[model samples]
Target chain A: MERDDIIEYSLHAHHSAEEGVKIRKKIYFVTALLSIITIVEVVVGVFISRSANEFANPGLWTSIKIGYIALTLIKAGYIVLVFMHLGEERKHFKWMILAPYIMFLLYLIFIALYEAVAVGHGMTL
Target chain B: MSGEASKTIESKVLWGGKVSPFSISYGKMMMWIFLVSDALTFGGLLVALGFARHAAVTAGEFWPSSEQVFTHFPFTHAHLPLLYVAFMTFILIISSVTMVLAVEAGHRMDKKKVAFWLALTVVGGLIFLGSQVWEWSTFIAGPDGDITTWADNATLKQNFFLPTGEMVDGAAKLGQEGPHAYAMFFFFITGFHGFHVFTGVLFNFIILMNVLGGTYEKRGHYEMVEKVGLYWHFIDLVWVFVFTFYYLV
Candidate 1:
């Protein structure tokens, strides 16, 4: 019996050579994008550390930190959407998978920040 | 059976008992559910880390910076901040790409290509795991040279010395202080992430074996690769969060 005769499910759509090339291109694009973001993050990190008294300006440091977080989130989003094949999923399915997590993450962050501040204050007193 | 009763049953049991409400395969949907729960577990750990760091900082104690703690790279005594971690992150992201490629190949029923990409993905995972091991060892052993303080009782503290042999601030003690708290959280958070990476590597190896054995070929679909790919990407995604929360922040 042929190897192809026993299989039952079609998890992926049929693709042509052009589609294959497109997929490979997408993979390269994702890799390059993630690498660039990482480089930017490292450069920013090293730069801020090397600069004399950069931390003295709390505002500037906070902004840089926020930028670092934003970049990381972007990289993660790209990885999930493209590499994880979430982007190709149906709209409702994507929402079903993502919405609850996003809401919960926000809630957790709020609770953590609030409680941490309270703990900090209590420790000081 | 009456026509009305039969129609009602058919409507309720969609897709001939497959019952995929979201139109995804059972395996893929289950994988997504598992990933979501795993993500929440990571989230809880990270949030705890955040709270711990916040408490330490608010207490006006000395918190050891990430650069100070993670400066050592493999085979080099130089102090390169974030470089090794950056390499680890790149390796993981690249492995994600390779896993996607394997899925793509599977879509085409190209067994050879699928196996090749899966092998590369496994290699990438192994390299990442090895790097983590090296990192964990360096963390546990800490920097050389002990600094002693003469208090009521003489205590020996391991100071993290720079390549130039200069000790960082607040490096001498490790009991309920800022730096100590920082070290504890660092160990816990990164250790947890490293555990996931280890498991992911193991999972990739299992899937790779299946690929090489032509199990997928026999099954006529590479859905297994895609399922594992989802898991592998989740690991990379969690690392992105860990890298940000622990290292960059």
Candidate 2:
């Protein structure tokens, strides 16, 4: 079937070669961004572990650990926003999909960490 | 009177005619719901991991450090920590990019470009699956020649030599209970993620077959490709969390 014959709702119409090229550039851009982030993560993982020594002073190590989590979250956000096309979604729809889950996850993590620490104390006592 | 009666009858019907409040197609909306639920499932597992690790720490048990554990790279015997997993992450991320491209091509009604990018996406997924398999085996086999006592015995040992030759109390040994708990959690979490990746590969393969068969061509729209792209991207997104919880953090 030809594009003209299709009777369906679509976000964009048929495009020329220039439009295709533009999309290709965007794809490469996303790829490059993800690649650089992954590289920075690996670099940090290797060097920070060597320099800080997670066992010696866990406090310093933890700050570095927080940095890793931040980077990972950033990467995750980018993938969800761009690759999943959630960024293109209507704002209300995006919030409807994302907000509850984010809040719930935060709650779960908090409860788990707190309870785990309490349990550890019990075991030690 | 006739017009008023007809309007009353229309309002009385069961279906709401056009109730897509989100302004998205039914399939896309359904995919979003599934993705949200799937994300929660992963969140639960990761939270459990955090609990386990924290408890081990509190009880003075040995919890294995991910950096020390995932140091093996492919081919060369030298320990290149996180390199292989980084490669796997890049493969998955690039595959996600290809999936977006396929969706864009679908928007343009460019069948050839859609098929081409979709094929590359599938290949990327396959490579990632293969890498995960290798990683699982290497993990199960234990890191490079029994570097720790836990390798020989599942029991957590208090003392193990770090890659830097510094001796430290392994998290498994803190409570004097051994590393079995740590190992079990590691296997279960990564195995679960791997299963998701496997299913994702299968999903992509089916979609690719349909694309090759020109099913979308006949339908006049490649919305099916877009739907599967949502799923593919979800799989990648889950891996981002898993990678952080399992390896990086």
Candidate 3:
């Protein structure tokens, strides 16, 4: 009975074939999509820099920043999902690993943006 | 089943079902855990780099536009955007493929094939390292004329201070900012990654020799292939992150 119970729990915890295949497909699709988006981001970052137009002024930089973040998130998502095998992991394990990271990242971002904005305001003065 | 056989089975089952320091081979499981920790370190560095970029850009420092900085041919003064990084990316990817092939050969117990594939992977790694060296030299040299040196190795201060106590402008100034902390980060990160590649090549070489000596053959299956493959793939995965964060971003 003890051995049977152990086997049952492990079988549940162990990575399954059906899930692996699905995750693999998802990874492939995400990689292709991310590659396309990366190309677009590089082109826009480079080409738009040369322009002296109004849309190129504040808007171009803003767009580039947003694009960079979006692309990074997609790449990170794929890395975690596929290479790290998080996609097929137990929901509790996933949360345990990533939740702290997500929280800390957001906190760091807030502090950085706040400092940067303050510095910019000071520079203006 | 016979009583002795049944007893033997019970003993096996009892021990096998439990997770113990001895039951789980510490070496292999530790490798996985170490790899995961290394991944987190890389992730954190990249995140910190992201934060730096965000803060600096918002603070009115003209981000060295990636296109303009990277645009260069060996001899001719021509601007080629995304060409160098793309070439480097392709080289790393090809090396990754060769690494996979080496792993396959190891699985088949083909020592010669594994050695050959691993050697190619090493060559590819060397080429990538050479390319990185050139990139770093160009970055530190600071254009054709201006000699900008960072005052101190401080992260807070922009390293590129002019002789006139001003930030180096676009035009080739007489005394420019020496390489800043950004350049330092670039060198350290890429240099560290290159060192991993170098060491990985050595690991493959050792494995090749072991295989030639009939070590794994005597032991049974080629599980070493799986172990090394994990390292090889981890290297490739790191490159993917580096290529994204360092170049495109």
Candidate 4:
């Protein structure tokens, strides 16, 4: 009976066999897969920065900045959605966690860029 | 249904028993409440960062360029921008990973492994805090032989010229230089976050001692680690925004 109990505990812990196995494996696989996407973010950021430095033009520079922002947003979104398990949650829960944040972040970004750009009112781009 | 009611009554009595008065687990609930408060703290910091940026302290004169302020010795001394911040970001991400592993070990009830990972997380926190100190010192450069402080990029841009000619009145002529309110905000926000990390490491150290001494062994589970892990993760989450707004953005 002791040997049987040990086997049952091992299986339950390792597979979560008592709860189920497929969901656990899926979470594990998804986490490993998303790690590749994170590596892509670093690589893309470096590439954009390198190219911007090489060309050293205003238009190219703006594009590089956009790319950086977009890539960062992607990485952040993925981490929140997957690692934090916000994606698997109910829709209302998702909005409860993210909506206010989106609104607040937008407000901050608007203020930052607006003030930054408005610094020199009469100066030409 | 009757059996369920009896179990509920038993649980209520058990929870109300002496030596542990909480209905729910005290540690886990406290962690949640702490995280809620911490979220507000971070939100306020970000809002303050926005306010400072909106104040336009530099304006057209200096424009407060991050690239200029952060030039350092990592790649080359001539002029490297934002690289140090990127390194700091990497340090934080790695620390968060170690923290997750520590929590994982705790879940597995591996006391020694939990202690080892917690120590790693503490060391990572210390290293990151040390890097911030170095970053700050480099930012506030020393006076030269002629008593002229180094002209940072912000000053140069504010001057609207490459070479900042001279000081107007113990201040650089190139830009609207000198410490401002925004500087105060930066120091306060970063200092507060660093203090959290420092205190967090101390808290984890206490838990480590307790675990090592078999206090947790008698307690029947490693719930303390789970409680502290929540705080540590919240700290890491706040750093994510700090890196973006304060450094990258």
| TM-score (chain A only) of candidate 3 | 0.65
In order of TM-score, best first, we have 1, 2, 4, 3
lDDT of 4 by residue, B1-249 (tens): 543233443332232232222233444545655665676777777776665555443343333434434556433555445566666666666666566555555556667877887788788888888888876655555211121465553332333222234432223454555436556666788889989989888887888888788776665566677567767766766776676566444
DockQ scores for all the models shown?
0.49, 0.45, 0.15, 0.11
- Please give, for residues A22-100, the per-residue lDDT of candidate 3 as tens digits: 6446545655665666566666655654222213366666666566767767765764555444565556556665687
**Chain B TM-score for all candidates, comma-separated:** 0.80, 0.82, 0.72, 0.76
Cα error of candidate 1 at position B227, Å: 0.6
Off by over 4 Å in 1: A1-8, A50-54, B1-16, B143-178
Q: Report the lDDT tens digits of candidate 1 across residue range A2-48.
A: 56433245434457778999989988988898999988888777667
Model 1 pairs whose backbones collide: none
- The whole-model lDDT of each prediction reads 0.75, 0.75, 0.57, 0.56
Counting clashing residue pairs in each candidate, in order, gives: 0, 14, 6, 3
Minimum summed lDDT over a 10-residue window in model 2 chain B is located at B6-15
Give the interface RMSD of candidate 4: 8.7
Instruction: Itemize residue pairs with steric clashes in candidate 3.
Output: B148-B176, B148-B177, B148-B178, B149-B177, B149-B178, B160-B177
Number of the candidate with higher TM-score, 3 or 4: 4
Clashing pairs in 4: B61-B158, B62-B158, B159-B174
**What is the C-alpha lDDT profile of model 2 across B89-128, one tens digit per residue?**
8898889988999888987778888989999998998899
Q: Indicate the fraction of true inter-chain contacts that candidate 4 also forms.
A: 0.03
Model 3 over residues B149-244: C-alpha lDDT tens digits?
423322123223322343323433423433355666677777778777777767767776776777776654455654665576677668777866
